[model samples]
Target chain A: MLAFKLAFKNIFGAGYRTILNIAVLSFAFVTIIFYNGVIDGWNQQARRDTIEWEIGQGQLWHPSYDPLDYFSYQDAHGPIPEGMREEVSAGRLTPILIAQASAFPQGRMQGVLLKGIPPGQAILKIPTHELEAQDGQVPALIGKRMAQSIKMKEDDRLLLRWRDKNGAFDALEVTIAGVFDCNVPTIDGGQVWLPLAQLQEMLGMPGEATLLVAGEGFTPTGNTGWAFKDHDYLLADLNKIIQSKKGGSGVIYGLLLIIALLAIFDTQVLAIFRRQKEIGTYIALGMTRWQVVGIFTVEGAAYSILAILLGALYGGPLLWYLGKVGWAMPSGSQDMGISIAEKIYPVYGAGLIITTVLLVVVSATIVSFLPARKIARLNPTDALKGKIQ
Target chain B: MESIIQIKGLTKQFPVGAGKFTALRDISLEFHRGEFTGFVGPSGSGKTTLLNIIGSLDTPTEGEVTVLGRSIAHLTHKQSAQLRNQHLGFIFQTYNLFPVYTVYENVEFALLLQRLPTAERRKAVLDALEWVGLTDKMDSKPAQLSGGEGQRVAIARAMVKRPAILLADEPTANLDSKNSHHILQTMKQLNEELQTTFLFATHDEKVMGYLRRIISLEDGRVVKDEEIIMDKITEG
Candidate 1:
């Protein structure tokens, strides 16, 4: 306790030196926390946007379904799962039928993924409610990215071609009902949504779907003809992308840590060198060499405590302000082929805050201890004389 | 009377180039209760080295020294520190008070090291400061103090523990004549009142004049030891 008090006194007594050290460390604290908070916010926003725009609470895929393999999608369609029929009728489950097709927009041919969804279903946010089952022409909904790619627009007329279950080629003219804008690229780019029943009838395959999306708060009771995909498994690829992003950000974190520790280490070394006479005075006043060393080490470590306090003093308001206004991403960031919002709010999580604080405190203590041990080996007589050796 | 410090044939040496140079040689001395003594010498006469050995700052290279009942040569580093902390107080010529601390804090430091109770530590520190006529300068930092005042604070620090012996090395070397005489008078009065044994290593005659006994050293050997009449001694 005496060592701590004395060290505290010594640190504040150091005037500008102590303040400079504290400022450097506090800057590190704010930067580290802010960088981590942004990454966490991006991850959170990605997960949420993916959920609302693509996968709802969870997904159920056909046994043969393999999104990466187009041929497998041909075999992916099957009759509706028997157990999910009631939920499907109650609007709790939404089934989507996928097929590969091509569209001729302004006489230019472009490949597309033909997705069929219930016009009145509320399970996802695709704006398929604008779809009509039997207009004078098939009414379709396309995303802005798809519309831009095909040179099509709202209410444009186009020709879509596909094959039936029996391998017969067919074509039809469709009227674009609406163009839905979404953050999820998987749903937005090169995709067209039509009424489920109409597409089922057009393909000559009634009552078949490639996937079923459960609404929010729905739980799977048991196995149907399809395999149940929980949220984690469904978002596994996104998690991988986030983990890779965290690794990339880890380099920045490492660089910041190196810079911070170097400053602290330098300060500790300089202070110990300059205070040799004081160290000797401590020993002469009846302090054990270890106790003198403790005072020095504790004085160095106390800088971190002040840094944390200083960081909170300025960083708290800065973070809160940033959180409220959010960080506006660079324009056209959505084309990166990942789901991301235009603005991301940084989150201050307990886990992140605690981990960062612990890392800083422990590192500061270690850096302090290294130089202070040098004092213990000094001869008191030489130290009292202020001899460098 | 039992001796508080006992030194027998004590010698200290330092490595110089290839051979060793001896600082003190074949010196035997005993310091007892309430003695105000000074080791008088010129430069390189080993007065400070002898004081260092007795203060447990250095060990004798050839012989044994026992102070306050503990053998200096056999004690570990921690035990040596314990001896200094518990039974000995030191005042240096440079007045090496912690520059950042106030006069009172400087005086309170030794008591804090001993982990004395707060009330007792406060009283002892205040009393010691009063003895040195520095109670009014309790809040003055070392940088704010004059040379004599700094030395006085050092004296108060050393005496706050009321140790059995006080070791001062060139205590008046940095002070002016007036400050020197004033500090010496304070020390004389402290010796009379507290009966604290005072030992000094000095080349300053002004310091010598205040001592009750003077031991003269030359070339690592004691040449003369004489008791002085306190009434007749005068500062040159």
Candidate 2:
């Protein structure tokens, strides 16, 4: 307690020097929390967008299906399993058929994935119900990115050509029914959606699908020929991407902490060098050498405490405002081949805040203690005379 | 009178290059309670070294020196500190007052080490300030005081704990004659009223004139030990 009292007095006596150190340390504190909060916000937003726009609660793939291998789409489809038929009719499961195709828009050839879903399917947010055929033309839906690339709009006609299961090529004209906006790039780019029955009939493969999406809270109990993949398995790639981003942010955190701690360490070294007589005075007043050391150490650690308070004074409102209005990404960020929303709302979790505070405080204390240990070796006689020993 | 300090064959040495330099040679001395004694010598004559040894700030290299009742040679660092904290007080030539602390805080520091209660600590601090005639400057920081006022504050800090012994090394070295005489008179009054043993290391004639006894050192050896009769001293 005595050490604390003396330490506070000494720090305040330092005046502007104390404020400068606190300002630097508070910058580090606020920067660390802000960066981590932004990354976490992106992680949360990306995961949510991917789940809502592409993957549902989970997915079930045909035994031969490999989403990464385009050739696997040829043999990936089979008749819907009898057990899952009831679930599919009940809207608990939605089957989707995918076929690699090419589209000619304005006499330009572009490769695309033609996905077929029930017109009334509610399992995903693709606006598939807009795919209702009209005026003897098959209606199709495309994401905003795809529509922009193809230079087409609603009611525009395009020639789509694909090979049937029997190795026969067929061509058809489809009218663009809708162009939906989505944040998940994988689901938005280079994809077109058509009515399930129309695509199945065109491909000469009726009552067949390449994959089944499980709706929310629908658990698959019995095993069919198709394999069931849980949420973790389906979202592994997205998780890995988020983890890598966090690792990159960790480096920033380290750099900020090192700079702040270096300043504190330098201040402590100088204080010990300059306050020798004061140290001797304390010893002469009945304090042990260790007590003197404690006073200096506490003096250094007190800088961080002051910084925390200063940071809260200014950073609190700034962070709260950022969390509410969100940070807007660059216009072309959605083309980065990852799931990123237009604006990211930072989420400052209590755990992240507490962990950051502890890390910085503990680090500052250890740095402070390092130089203070020299006090234990100082000779009180020499110190009293302001002599270096 | 109680024998508060006893030194026998005491010596202190410092390493100089590859060789050892002796600061105090084999010497014996004794001091009793309430005695105003000074070790008078020129610079590097070991007067300060002897006072430091008696104050328990440094251990004798080759002798058993006892302050109060604890052997300086055998006292651990903590025990030495405790002895100094509880029974010994020190004043320095530079008046090493904590620059940031006010006069009151500086005086209160010693009692704080003793963990005195609030009311008791307050009374002791105020009394010590009154003794040094610094009651009006209780809230003034060390840098804001003159040389004499600073020395007086230092004196208050040392006397605040009411220790049995006070070691002062060139306490008036930086003060003018007027301040020096004033500081000495205040200390003399404290010695008479409280019976606190006053020990000093100085070559200043002003300080020597006020001493009841003088131990003169030359080249690390005590060359003269004399008791002064008050009637023979001229008032200056």
Candidate 3:
């Protein structure tokens, strides 16, 4: 306990050197916390956006359905079972028909997915009310990305070609009824939404859909020829993406830790090297070599106390403002191939702050102790003479 | 009088360049309680080496050194430190005061190591400071003190715990002639009043004038050991 008091006194006694070390360390503390908070916030926002836009509570897929195999579009679909009809009408289940098609807009051919959703249902976030056919023309809703790629505005017309369920080619003019903005690239890039019945009739598959998306409070009680997909199973691909992203972030975390620790290590080394006379003085004044080591270690570790206080003094307002206003993601975030929202509001949990404090304090103590242990080997008499060796 | 320190066939060696260089050779010495003695010598004459051996800061390299009846040669590092903490004090040529600590804290540090209670420790520190005439400078750090004042603070620090013996190595080397005499007088007064043994390693003539006994060393061997009687000891 007395060693702690002496150590505290010594740290403050160091004057400007103590201030410089604490300032550098506090910046590191705030920065590490901020980066971790931002990454977690991004992960949460992506998950929420995915749930609202693409996948609902869960999904049910036909036994043969494989989204990666475009050729399976023909075999992956089956007629909606009798059991799902009532639930589908009541909006607890949403049926989507998927087919491969190509559009020639102003002499340019682009492959796209033709997704058929019910016009009156509100199970998803898409604006499906505009999917009603206008004067026998197939009304289609395209994303802003698709609209930019094809340079097609609302009320414009494009020719779409597709193969029917009976191995027949059919083509029709699809009129762009709306161009919508969304963060989920799956729904917004090279994909068009049209009415379910019109698409089923056009493809000669009158009562079939590729998969069924379950809505909130939906319970699957065994439907024939359909396998129930739980939330974890449906979001497995997204989880894998997020996990890899976390792995990448670990590299960055490691770099930040090394930079901070290096600064601390350098300061400790210099202090020990410069203060041999002090070490000798302490020994002469009745301190054991180990006690001298402890004084130095505590002096080094004491930086964390000031670092944390300063971090909170400045970081509290900055983090609170960030939590409210959120971080604005860069313009081309969607091109990075992860579901990042336009803006992500960082969430700083109590667990994050506590863990960071423990990590920094422990690390500082260890780093401090290692260098000060060198004092144990010093010759006290020679050290008293200010001998370097 | 009980012997406070005993040395038998004591020798210290330093490994220089290729072989060992002997600093002290086959020296036998004993010091009684309440003695004011000076080991007088020029540089490299083994005076400081003898003091370090008796203070438990260095090993004998050849023979036994017993301080306050404990064999320093067989003492573990911790035991050696305990002996020094409880029974020995040291004043250095450079004062060696902690630059960051005020005079009061520096003096209080000795009592602190003994785990004395706060009130007693305060009294002890204030008493030590008063003895050195630095009561008004209790809050002043070492940097603010002159050479004489700094040495006085060091004397207060060394004597605060009232150790049985004090080891001083060239304690007056950095002080001017006037300050040197002043410190010597203070130490002589403390030695008489407290009945504390004082051992010095120095060649300063002013320090030699205040000594009741002088052991002269030359080339790693004691050449003269004598007691001097004078009608009047110089107050300086």
Candidate 4:
């Protein structure tokens, strides 16, 4: 402890050098913090969009559901297991039947996959539904592109006709309660969400659903796949499926780590050069050679700690701002206009910050080792003579 | 007086390129407790090398240096450091004060080497400072003081720990005549009052005149070992 205190005092003793070294480290700190924040924010945004679109916190599939299966929903049957319902008792689960169908809205028709959702339960899961300006009545939300194709609006009438299992035309009257907008333009243009009861009646399956999509924070002990638990997992899976074609955050983070290592190395090497005489003096005064090495290593560690503190002070607020106003990606289709969130969400995780600080300090200290060793091997007479090599 | 430092035919060699140069040839010397002794030699006469051997800064190539009954020739580097801390004090001609430390802090460094308690160290340091008549300038840094004041601080540092032996390498080389005389008197007073052994390497005549025993060397070999017999009139 006494040696550590002495080292600390010596570092601060050279006031101008300490300040200059910190300034150089600060530049690296800002670069690393901003890069980490942006990548993390984008990842979180993708997860949010994924969970909002398809999978909820806990998704239940059959015990036979394949881990590598892309067509599980098409082969599955019935709604969620009875026990799974009790697990998420506080949050509602929406049973959905997804099937491809040919729709003729006004004689110019196209094939669209109609996802029959449990209407009342889905209201709590969709972001728009939760934030709707309701006036004492529940509204059926239809995508903007679906409304535009049928030339419909709120209170407008539309006829959705599809062929059933028996090859007979099954038609229904769906009132356009409201027009909805999600950032994914392709899904918005082709997808239509209807009440499960209405779909069952039209297709003549009185009380059955093919798939179940729950909201965030659902847990099922028996069986589940592609499931989400809390915000982080949901974001991870969401980023995986939604932004699969774009550049990933892992590459960006790797590059950022390299830059951080180089910056810390440069700064620590400079600091070692400036304190050459002092280190030699300490060694000549009966300090162990390793003790001399330890003092500078500790100084490097202190630099990392200070940089992390400063980075957190700035990065926290920056992430919060990004979460409030996320960025957008351009959509290739006119009808299905693609735009991600305007600003990405920030995650204030303690583990990530600590790991980053440790990484920076360890690399910087290792870089400073060559100089520390050189000082330890210095002849006492040469040191007292003030000769530099 | 019992011998505090015993040397047996010590030698040191320095490598210059492919050939080896002898810095100190086979020679032996002893330092007794409570003695004021001086080693006088010309430049490159191996005075500094001999001093370093006694101070445990350099190892002998052929023989052993036993200080306080411990063989330093075979001790590890760490053990040598421990030995120096426990039994040795050094005053350099450059005054080697840590530029960032005040005179008080510089003096306290020696006591800290002994690992004494803070209160005891403070008392010892202040007392040493008073002994050198630099108590009024204890708070001043070496850069803020004259060359003489800096040398006095170095003296206080060497004496503060009250080690078994103090090694001084040309302690008055940088000081003027007046400061040199004052420093010599202060050292003599310390030797008489504290009964501490002082060993110095010097080329100055003033330093030789103040010593009770002088050993002169040329070509890395001792040429004369003179003991000044004190008379009653000369003592005054």
Which window of ten consecutive residues has the lowest lDDT sum in model 4 chain A?
A123-132
Cα lDDT listed for each candidate = 0.87, 0.89, 0.86, 0.67
Off by over 4 Å in 4: A24-53, A60-93, A101-112, A122-124, A127-140, A143-176, A181-189, A197-208, A214-236, A239-277, A306-341, A353-370, A374-382, A385-389, B228-236
Question: A218-317, model 1: which lDDT tens digit per residue?
Answer: 7788778688888899899988988888888878877877777788788888887788878877887788899988887787679888989999999999
lDDT by residue for model 1 (B1-236), tens: 56888989998898889999999989998889889999998989999888878888878899889998999999888998998898888999899888788999999999998899999999999999999999999999999999999999999999999888999999999999999999899888888888889999998878887888999999899999998985666542
Best-fitting candidate, measured by DockQ? Answer: 2
Q: What is the C-alpha RMSD of each candidate to the true structure, in Å?
A: 2.3, 1.7, 2.3, 5.9
Clash tally for model 3: 0
Question: Candidate 2 or 4, higher DockQ?
Answer: 2
Residue ranges of candidate 1 with Cα displaced over 4 Å: A132-137, A147-153, A216-218, A221-225, B15-19, B234-236
Chain A fold similarity by TM-score, each prediction: 0.94, 0.96, 0.93, 0.65
lDDT (tens digit, per residue) of candidate 4 on A1-389: 65556655665676765565555555455555555555566556545555666566545544444323535534544545565556434555566655555565666676666666654465233433432324543334567667787676776655567755455787655556667765444346666666665666666655555645566455445544423344454345445543553245446655665555555456556655655556545654666667767776676666565666666677567656754665343443334233355444544456656666666667666755655566567665555555546
TM-score of 3: 0.94
Which pairs clash in model 2? Answer: none
lDDT of 1 at B16: 88
TM-score of each: 0.94, 0.97, 0.94, 0.77
